[model samples]
Target chain A: MAENKIEIRNLYKAFGKKKVLNGVDLDVKKGESLVVIGGSGTGKSVLIKCIQGLLIPDSGSIKIDGVETVETSENIHEKMGMLFQGAALFDSLSVWENVAFVPLGKGKMSKKDAKTEAIRVLRQVGLAPDVADLSPAELSGGMQKRVGLARAIITKPEIIFFDEPTTGLDPIMADVINDLIIESARGLGATTLTITHDMASARKIADRIAMLYHGKIIWIGTVKEMENSDNPYLQQFITGNAQGPIQVEV
Target chain B: MLKKTLGTFLQTLGKAPLAFIINLGYFTQFVAKSVYNCFMPPFYFRLFGMQFLNIGFYSLPVVGLTTLFAGMVIAIQTYSGISEYGAESVVASVVLISVTRELAPVLSALMVAGRIGAAMAAEIGTMRVTEQIDALITLSANPFRYLIAPRIWAAIIVMPLLVLFGDIIGIFGGYLVGVYKLDFNPANYITNTMDFMKSTDIIMGMVKAGVFGFIISVMGCYHGYRSKGGAQGVGEATTNAVVTASILILIANYLITELFFAR
Candidate 1:
């Protein structure tokens, strides 16, 4: 068996009376890409946040590299990078400054050298070096997403999380982002966890697919298995049907 | 129906104090964390400079104008009030003591609380809404250290300096009114002002400035950091920061005065 890079077991999270993640258990092996598909408000984002330690789970265990993360004092995110939905770039900072934020803020590199590194990563994301000095507000939506991608991979982290990476893009732009994500993650040989309702993105990037329904993982398999599976929940989701075991809650 | 209403009312009453205590505990932890981070390494000196420029230098015009008008008005009012008893000379002393001991520090702090406190809350609250703050944490940086510490330090350092400048401008305002408007001997007015001014009074004013500065920045940061939802949340945070800072400044002014001058 390959080494599991991330292991989440019996995870549960809720806000007030609303339960988001109810006993979710999953694992991502090293260098594999896992895409979680779920409807809106089905706890996809919360699950990723719980894994990133952004939200404390109400109960259960999350182990990164076999060490329990709950209440641990270690800096688990040092090896992790994420591209937030909407890009979430610092409006106050320029492109290179945003890309170099981690190293610069941590005092690990000089500004000049960090900018140089930023330009290099921007190029890898198919952006020109001249785009380095432009503030994030100056960039278009597509360009902003590219910059966010560049920042995520700037540190060449061992694990990357992409949250709704193609939600707001056009079809062509979405395809470009999906391709870039695959290339970048493959280039670093990094493990990745992506959450999106975009099936095109999932099909293009996922090595294995999981379906989350009502805060539980209803199906887990390869893309081929997902396509061939007889699971009604997965079938209802993949077909985009409203009438099924999953209620639209409209 | 009556029982249900009574139960609901009792529950709300019971929850209010608990909620207040919880929020107070959170604010105390925030302050302790920020203070501890202020002395740690990896300090962002550039951010410190930016905050100082924002909190101190930009605040000069407002602080200067407010204190100037206050001093002039105090001089004019004192002249009219004391002249009723044929004690016109007391105008110089009254204006001098009031400006140095009360007007300069308190008024300048209130002005800053309006400007800088609201600004800090809006800026940080926007960051929170946009996920930039969470981005900082995911990037392995402590938001408190990177965001809050520098502002707190800048406010504490610059507030006293701003108040000092306000004192000078305020005293000069009094001088202008005493010399030009009241037709007093400029030399004797100057002498009475100088003779009545104590170093302790100026020091106390500056000390109050420092405390008020801390309060303004802390309230701003606390509200901003805790803000949730979106634009509406940020707006609420900015308003709360200003309101709480202004009220705390007034309350603290009384407490500090009692500590310094109560007989």
Candidate 2:
């Protein structure tokens, strides 16, 4: 299990005439928690989406578990789970229905047993069992995030992806979510790839941090190493300074 | 300056058709994929059942009422016009033919396009914008299989039945107006209606309803599935779905009528 869980080589994707991902190369090791930090609209999401096969790259190769994924007409989705930024729970479905979407949808579990399984997973994400029957619209933002996390981990995927997990939460709730993400991924022993601009959450959850800039990774190191590094872009981003090598278009 | 202006004009002229052709191709591909998924294995019988109830069963009141009034108005208008020619007895035959062949199928389809098409677009558009569709893909669920096929299948299956019921209600409406208001004998009206009623007219009407159902579901699902951005995008999709489906229903009506009735 010492092999790379995911590998990407020179990925490029563009929409219409606007280039979103120029040329990105990345890799994730087995059971590794790799957090990518970047400013908004820097192709962080595009990179992860390409790996998930949601968006096909213009010219690239993506391999999962030593198997090539890009340009292949195959279904490799069962091995992966994702927690979207807005939670993205189906509004028409109840909380437990959202959590157990996979097993219930595939008819792998009976309705009664599926509800029980959903409640158990919801509890693992710190949600109460009673919350299972309520609609996703009735849940608060934090609770929705928990439900999304529960859904992601319900499949016990070999690789999990988190997109802006702590974006719209209070600091306490953010910390709580970060802690739950860590516990869930650790318990599943999944290789996790998370994208965010939250430095604190990055520090708390990442084994190694990579900074994405202008569609490519600029710096990568441990937390201590990142603190001491002199890369101007990484330093500027970490400090959240306006006057720096990285410019915000405002 | 003149050369440059001509070049720019030509470029603008060329771009519109190219864009239209590209969009047409995409829409055709979407229709093809959805139709293929409708017949493939792993069919969702449960979803189809739900959509049948929603699209067919719930639409009865609106469809029934519309056809009834149309039939009544036709009976009154025909009596007024033909009574001048000393042909008052011909009103029953005219009402029966017109109701089954033109009014019942077309009017009911238009109503459904307004109700179900707009609703399907709004619901699926919301799912697309909120990323629930993407979530389904990530969860190993095919959106075409899970969402589009069931809807299109239900529409096609239930539309003919709706029109058949509408035909009966419309004929009864004409009978009510003829006997109650026009002082025509009930026995004579029934005999006239039965004499004029033909299997071809009813079958053609059912075919028209089925085709309109396909058009409505395709337009709604296509617009909604392609919607992006956010709330404004969804609004545009809903509006487009109803507008396009209505227009297509009208056009298909003419084509089908010509195919069957044109001399």
Candidate 3:
């Protein structure tokens, strides 16, 4: 079995009166893809944010490369990349600049070299060289997602997170993004964690799938295993049934 | 029933001061952190330069036009009243002192509070709601260093220069009204203006300008950085930035005046 690249144990996080993550225990092996499936407001984003050190958990342990990362994640941040649900590109910079922001900001590469490198990465993501100079706003939704993917992979991080990378996209574009995610992660051999409610996306990208319900991981298994699992919540979720243990707030 | 009603009333009354204290503490911590980071290494000189141009160079016309009209009004008003007392020369001195020591600094700072402060809030607030700030963190960029510090330093450094420009323009406006409109001897008006003008007055206005600049940028950045919800949240932050900055400028103006000229 591969060694774990990321380990989360007994994670707990809550807002004022609502517990978002209740003792979530998850792990992803080195160079593996793990997708967490949950309904809206079920703390999927919060779980990833805790790992990214964007939100402080109420109690838990998150280890990356065997080092505890709850207190300080600055060093850990260098080994990780994320694609936000909104494709949160810096509007102030050009597309190439956004792609090369990390290297350019760190002064690790000259502007000319960074631009060349950014264009190369953009090409790998299926963007034309002409798209390099345009702003993030000028691109279509699909293109912005590609630019965001390019940015996440440009540094060749050890781990990458995709937060609803397929949300707000057409079915074809969503599939295209799924293919790109596979290609990029496979190319880097990076550990990947993705959170989404899209079952097709989950099945397409996940080596193992976990179901989060009411702040807990109710079930986790391989895609084939998920199909045969008898857990009622998991069964109801995967089937997209309205009659189930889970109740829609609306 | 009466006791419960009184308890609820007291609780409601107490909440305001508690919230005020909490907000003040946050604002203080934010300002202190940003100021400390402003002097740290790996400075973003490019961002600072852009902010300097935006806050300083772009603010010239509004400052110029405002002070010019204010100075003309002072000259006309002072001339009419002082002429009744057969003391027309006091109009020159009054225009010089008031424009330099009070009007230019306050009015220019207020104008900039409306323009730059609101812009800082709206821009950063939008970035916040869209999760761009979180993205920057993942990308290893500190928001304070990359965003707040440049703005704070630019507003502080550029403000006194703006006030100096305002002083010259304002005094000239008074001169225009005094000599051309009032038919006073141009040479006498110039002489009277220079004679009444003390370096202390100009120095005082510059000092006030610098303080006002700090207040404006801090309020704008603080509100924007903390803003949440979405578009409506950004809108609220913009309005709060302008209002708080304007109010603080006025308060600081009085405090600085008392500091410099208290008898």
Candidate 4:
């Protein structure tokens, strides 16, 4: 059994009267790629935010290497990097500046050195060095995502979170992102927690899959077990059925 | 029916003050945090330099033009109005007092609130909605230090300088109108303006500019930081920043004037 690098227990969060994460509990082992699958508005992103310490849970415990996160210092974030859903590149910054933001802002490197390192990381993410000085607004959706990926991995954090990694991309671009995610995680040997409803990406990348339904991880297993599972909700979600125990609000 | 109507009216009336107090408390806390972060370490000089350019250097032309026109208008009006009693010479003194003590700082701040304040709100609001602000947090950078403090500091430092320029241009405008347009002797007009000027007048205007600058930047950051929804929300924050900053500048102008000049 692999050692658990992340442990979440009884996480509860609510916005107004709507309870988003009712009692989410899950764990990801060391160096494991855990992809959380859920329907829209099923609290998958909220779950990721809770783990990232962006949104504080109303009640719960989130532990990273057994250190409780809630109300703790911001030191935990230093060990983690996240790729936001929209890429969220700073529009004011150039491609290289956005990628080198953390290092430059932290005063860890000179501007020239940071620019050099940024170009190297951008190249690692399959971008050319020529694209370095262009602003984020000048890039296409696919290129922006690549730049965001470069920014996320530039710090070489021990743990990485990918929020809706392939959102708003064409199928070919989505596949390319999936391949890059797998390659990057492997290269870093980092524990990764990716939240997305994209089954193809999940199947291609996840060492273990967890399905969040009504804010709970109701199913957890290998990709094959997920495909062969007898659970009705999991089956309905995987099959994309309209008539299932998980009712669509629409 | 009468009792129900009265009860509803009373409840509505009671809720307004309660909401006002609650909002005031939250705004106070936000300002407290921003001030605390301003004095803390890890200051971003690059961001500060960019804001100075945006708020101070870029605003120079508009502020200069506005004050110039303001001084010219005051000279013409005061000369025409007071000339009936054969007191056109008082025009120089009036223009100097009005521009240095009141018109320059207030008008310049209002212009900046419209320009820099709205832009700050919209830019920060977009960042909030798009999750760039969250990205900063995950990168372990305090948003206040990286984003808010630099803007506030730039506004404070740059405002007085802008107002000082506005005063110079304003006085020059009066000089043009008095000597060239109004047929007053250039030396007499210059001496009258000089004799009437006091250091306290310019100092008071600079003090008001500094306060107005703080208010404008704070409103922009507050509204933008709390913005939600999407594009519509950001638009609303931009509008609110300008409107609130303008109103606050007027109110603060009166209060500061009272503090300086009240008998």
Off by over 4 Å in 4: B1-22, B84-86
Count the clashes in each prediction.
Answer: 0, 0, 0, 0
For candidate 4, write residues A20-122 as lDDT tens digits. Answer: 9999999999999999999999999999998988898999899998889875765888889898889999998899999999899888899999999999999
Write the residue-wise lDDT of candidate 3 on A1-250 in tens digits. 8999989999999998999999999998999999999999999999999999999999989998878897564578899999999999999999999999999999989999999999999999999999999999999999999999999999999999999999999999999999999999999999999999999999999999999999999999999999999999999999999999999889
Please report, as a value between 0 and 1, the fraction of native contacts recovered by candidate 3.
0.90
Worst 10 residues of 2 chain A by lDDT: A69-78
lDDT of each: 0.92, 0.92, 0.94, 0.93
Q: Interface RMSD for every prediction, one decimal?
A: 0.8, 0.7, 0.5, 0.7
B70-168, model 3: which lDDT tens digit per residue? 999999999877644533478788889999999999999999999999999999999999999999999988899999999998999999999999999
lDDT of 2 by residue, B20-90 (tens): 99989999999999999998867989889999999999999999999999999999999887644534458
Please identify which of the two predictions, 2 or 4, would achieve the higher TM-score against the true structure.
2
Compared with the true structure, model 1 gives a TM-score of 0.97
Q: Supply candidate 3's per-residue lDDT for B7.
A: 100
Q: What does the lDDT read for residue B258 in candidate 2?
A: 94
Estimate the overall C-alpha local distance difference test score of candidate 2: 0.92
The residue pairs found clashing in candidate 4 are: none
Measured against the true structure, the TM-scores of the candidates, in listed sequence, are 0.97, 0.97, 0.97, 0.96
Q: Model 2: what TM-score?
A: 0.97
Compute the DockQ of candidate 2: 0.86
Task: List candidate 2 segments past 4 Å from native.
Answer: A71-74, B84-88
By DockQ, who's the top model here? Answer: 3
> For model 2, which pairs clash?
none
CA shift of B173, model 3, Å: 1.3
Instruction: Compute the lDDT of residue B239 as modeled in candidate 4.
Output: 96
